[model samples]
Target: MTTLILMVAGGLLGWSAYHKIPEAFAVAIAAAIMVLPVYLVASGEGRTQAEEDPAKEDPAQVLRRRVQAVNQAFTEAVALMDLLRRDLDAQQAAREALLAEAERQQRLLELNEEEAEKIRQILIGETKASIRAGRRRELRFFLAGILLSAALSIPIGIWVNSIS
Candidate 1:
């Protein structure tokens, strides 16, 4: 309200001052022709809703209010992003810790497998020794058994071949 009045008054005063100077009206007319349409378009058609309603005429106040609202919203958005960044950092740290723990567990599992292999080798050696002891006097018996098995296998194979 007051600002618009002041701006119009200033423009009129400046125009009046130019009119007093020699041939300044020519310059003013030329500038006016160039700028009048732009001002009319920028201000919108005839009377704005705010102009019809005097309570909303304070555009300067509205601009200040909008600026404050935007500033607050921007601050809140920044705070949210900061919190998200911190949470991501914490999550990354936890992931690194978990990875390190998994590596340690894997190392322990590999060590356990090596120990089990050593025990398995010892058991295999023991088993070989026991088998040798148990079969010490059965060498001739085993040889006879092998020869008989071979003779039976040859007869069976010949029978299968004839049938086929």
Candidate 2:
């Protein structure tokens, strides 16, 4: 309450000080002063709730909470599955881009390989190495991500899907 009152007062002060300026800027500043404190308080309360421990709670309540958590986790897993599919699509696009780049590099090397400017080969070699490393890393990580996601999420979905 004290914070709210102080914020309101600050907004009034800002509006009075800038009232002679553009009305839009004055309103924006005053509105920000009024709104920001409430947003901060609300976000702080949310963090506090998330930080609380569940271990001390009653057994029945704990069990109920566990069920709710599982359900919430399943919902999040479905969302992640969507994200994984999108990521895979992005990975495919990246592979296509790499292929196109490789074709361009091959053409460059073909046209210039015998020339003194074949120093460009060094640059292409570095690019090729980086592309291989990136592809290997992304493929392994992205596939594992999808598999791990499926491992956790598939059964959860099957279990909860019947409820609907």
lDDT of 2 at 143: 99
lDDT of 1 by residue, 1-164 (tens): 22343344345434654566422453344344434434543444455466556476687765564466556544544444344345446755886999999999999999999999999999999999999987975887898899999989999999999999
- Kindly list the per-residue Cα lDDT of model 2 for residues 3-60, writing each as its tens digit: 4534454455445544555434544554455444445543444333423565656668
Best model per TM-score:
1
- TM-score per model over all chains: 0.44, 0.27
Q: What's the true lDDT of residue 118 in model 1? A: 96
Candidate 1 TM-score versus the reference? 0.44
Model 2 steric clash pairs: none
Residue 82 lDDT (model 1) = 48
Lowest lDDT sum, 10 consecutive residues, model 2, at: 42-51
Model 2 misplaced stretches (Cα beyond 4 Å): 1-64, 111-164
